[model samples]
Target: MSIAIDFNHVVKKYGDQAVIPGLSIKVKEGEFFTLLGPSGCGKTTLLRMVAGFNSIEGGEIKFDEKVMNDVKPSKRNIGMVFQNYAIFPHLSVKKNIAFGLENRKTPKAEIERRVDEILRIVQIEKFKDRLPENLSGGQQQRVALARAIVINPDVLLMDEPLSNLDAKLRIELRNAIRKIQKEVGITTVYVTHDQEEAMAVSDRIAVMKDGYIQHAGTPQNIYHRPANLFVSSFIGRSNILNATLFATNDKTEIVIHDKHRVVLTNIRQELIKSTKTNVQVCVRPEEFLFTSDTNGLKGKVQRSSFLGLNTNYFIELESGETVEVIQESDIDTLIPEGSVVYLKLNQAKVNVFNEDGSVNLTEGVKNDAAGEVQSEVNNVAI
Candidate 1:
């Protein structure tokens, strides 16, 4: 059966160092949730807390509806797949998979049936008699997974299970793991520092930084509507520019680098009302288009390189700041290095932020009328 996992105000400190501070999150029953962050950002620590391997300094962890603060690791009924694969070298695949069931003293016949069923599910039935040293890395990982799931634990925790495999094998095994998780309908919490892997497999992701959650949302939401400057820069590539806000009776205009001006039509009126007139603007690398017209900001192409699907250019603006732009590789007119070109930003693709780096603009709006309409809707809803 699936179970919900909850971390309520969890804090873990090692001696004088605090690894996780007041972390709180919920993983729904049968959901695939990931904790994504850089090394030492407490993602693994948080996963260990849920696995009952690490003790919390404060707050509570609950499985289903029961508080698990004092629950033994064995009694927590959770399966964990580690990065090292942890398969016993001396035991055959069949024995490794049935080890958990045997520890619970299941009948010999029942353990045999369950082991066979899991081996087939993981498509490793042909290797049932083989030892760990005889199988490939991917195959051994599958064996580890099969062993973890044979007991049918309420929750499954994986800590960078694909980090050891080659790139191609990593992709293959990642898809296989996601497929198995969906088929079994087990609540899962995966920890990884690879943003691409987290985005590809997680139902929802919590991006952590400095031992705290920076943002939490679906992959699409986190990528397109990041909550802060750190999230915008971390999840993907974005060009952040300093700007000054100039608000009129209806619209908010941002002056970039003292020369270029952009009208921000998506900012909330309440947020703009509190603005101190200076802000920052974030633009994704693909949002700018190169043109020959004299209307936009002029920049010299510092370097341009073809990278498979797209061409990447490092452009130096008139103010000496460098910005990156991505365009289709097959474009007829290429901006050569040292050539001056006009860079036009699509107003629809810009994100505005306050001085403190919080997102100030709602994602989409083309004009003041749309902003007013959204404001009215928000007011009515509230």
Candidate 2:
């Protein structure tokens, strides 16, 4: 039975040092939740707290309203998959998956029934008799996954389970893990530093920094309408530009490079009411378009690279700051280096942040750290 997980101002301490001060988040039943951030950001520390491997100093960690702070690892009934495959080298794939059930003293016939079913679920039936040494990296990871889920634990905890595999194998196994998790319908808490992997696998992601959650929402919400400048830069590639904001009644206008202008009506009303100016703008690589008209930000192309579906250009703006621009690969010749180009901003998609890069002033952005998740995924303007 899958269960909901909730953290209520949870705190973790290692002796005198408090790694996680107070963190709160929610994971719906059967939802794939990912904790993503750079190293030492406390993502792993929080995951350990959930698995009962770390001591909780304050607040509560609950699985469906049942406090888990004092629960032992063995009594928690959770399955863990680590970065390194922790399978027994001497045991065959079949034995590795059935080891848990055997320890519980399950019937021999029931063990065979469950083991055979899990082998098929992980698609490693042919290698059931093979030892861990004989299997490939991807296959060994599959064995680890099969072992973790065979017990039908209430929750599955995976900490960078694919980090040890090659790039191709990582992609393959990530997709496989997502598929298997969905098929089994187990609530999972996945931890990783890989943003792309997190976005690819999670139903929702909690971006963490310094033991605090910066933002928590669906992949689209985080990518298209981030809560702050830190989240904007972390989840994907973004070009941060300094600009001035001016408000006239209901409409807001932003000027870049003292020349190019963008008018918006959907800015947060509070910002307009307060007449906040001198802000930072976050424009994605694909949000800038080349235009023949003079009413745009002027830049000189420095270099261009063709990456099959999209071509990337490195351009130096009039202010001498370099920015990356991505456009669809066209049949025409590539924009040569040294060519002056006028770039137009997609006004609807560009995000504006306060001078400190702490709050997003764009309309429809929640800007809440530990508050409720975005109820609407398509909060960005169309």
Candidate 3:
């Protein structure tokens, strides 16, 4: 059965260093929540705290209203899938999957029933008799998954389970994991350093930094409407251009290097003052469109490469800022390197950040009769 998990003002420390410093988060029942960050960013440490492998120094960690600060790991009744695919080489896939159930002192007939059901759920029934050494990496990982789920734990914790697999296997197994997770309806807390893995498999993701959550939202929100500069630059390939907001009589214009400017009709009211504070515009590489009109920003292609589905171009703007653009490969011809080009932003997906690294309150707004509100807002619930 699935259960909710909550972390309230949790704190963890290593000697004098604070690893996780007063972080509060909530994982709803049956939600596939992922903790994502670079190494040393405390994603793993947070997962370990949930699994009871690491203790919280300051606050409470509860599983469905049960205060588990003093609870032991074994009594947590949580199933964990590690990155190393900790299956016993001496045991067959079926036996490996049955280990958890056996340790729980479940009856023989019921263990068999659960092992068979879990193997089929992970699509590893064909390899049930094969040993871990006899199976491929993906197959071995499936066996490990079957083992974890066979016991029907209230929550499933995965710590970079797909990091050891190759690219092709990683994609295939992540898809399978997402499908199985939905079918099992287990409240899951997963940890990974991979952006694609986290974004592709998670129902919601908490992007972490310095043991604190930088942003928590759906993958689309984290990508399109990043809460701050670090999130915008980390979640995806973003070209952050320095721009200054100039207040005019009727509207605002974001001036770039004094020569190029985009009309900033939808901007936060506080920025409308005549004082010049630092501001930046975050645009994804795929959000730029090639245009022939000189009315847009002028740039020169520094380098160009044709990938399978898209051609990437590195363009140096007249302001000496480099912006990367990803164009579709179906174009009739490729723009040669050093070719002078004009580029314009789609604007709808653009995000603005203030000097203090907070998102501009009016970022991506669609102004009309209503006050400034984020455009393309979809399922903002974290």
Highest TM-score among the candidates is held by which one?
A: 2
Candidate 3, residues 131-247, lDDT tens digits: the string is: 888899999999888888888899999999999999999999999999999999999999998898989999888888888777777888788877677777888899988878766
| Candidate maximizing lDDT | 2
> Candidate 2's error at 95, in angstroms?
0.5
Candidate RMSDs in Å, in order, are 5.4, 3.3, 5.1
Assess every candidate by TM-score.
Answer: 0.90, 0.95, 0.92
10 residues in a row with least lDDT, candidate 3: 367-376
Clashing pairs in 1: none
Q: Candidate 2 lDDT, tens digit per residue, 1-382?
A: 9999999988888888878888888899999999999999999999999999998999899999899999999989999999998999999999999999998898999999999999999999999999999999999999999999999899999999999999999999999999999999999999999999999999999999888888888898889889888899999999999998887775688888787789977677654444547889999999999999888888999999999999999999989999999999998779999999989988889998877777777876643346322222224221
Residue-pair clashes per prediction, in order, are 0, 0, 0
In model 2, what is the error at residue 60, expressed in angstroms?
0.4
- Give me the displacement of residue 165 in model 3, in angstroms: 0.9
Model 3 residue 64 CA deviation in Å: 1.3
Off by over 4 Å in 1: 274-276, 331-333, 358-360, 363-382
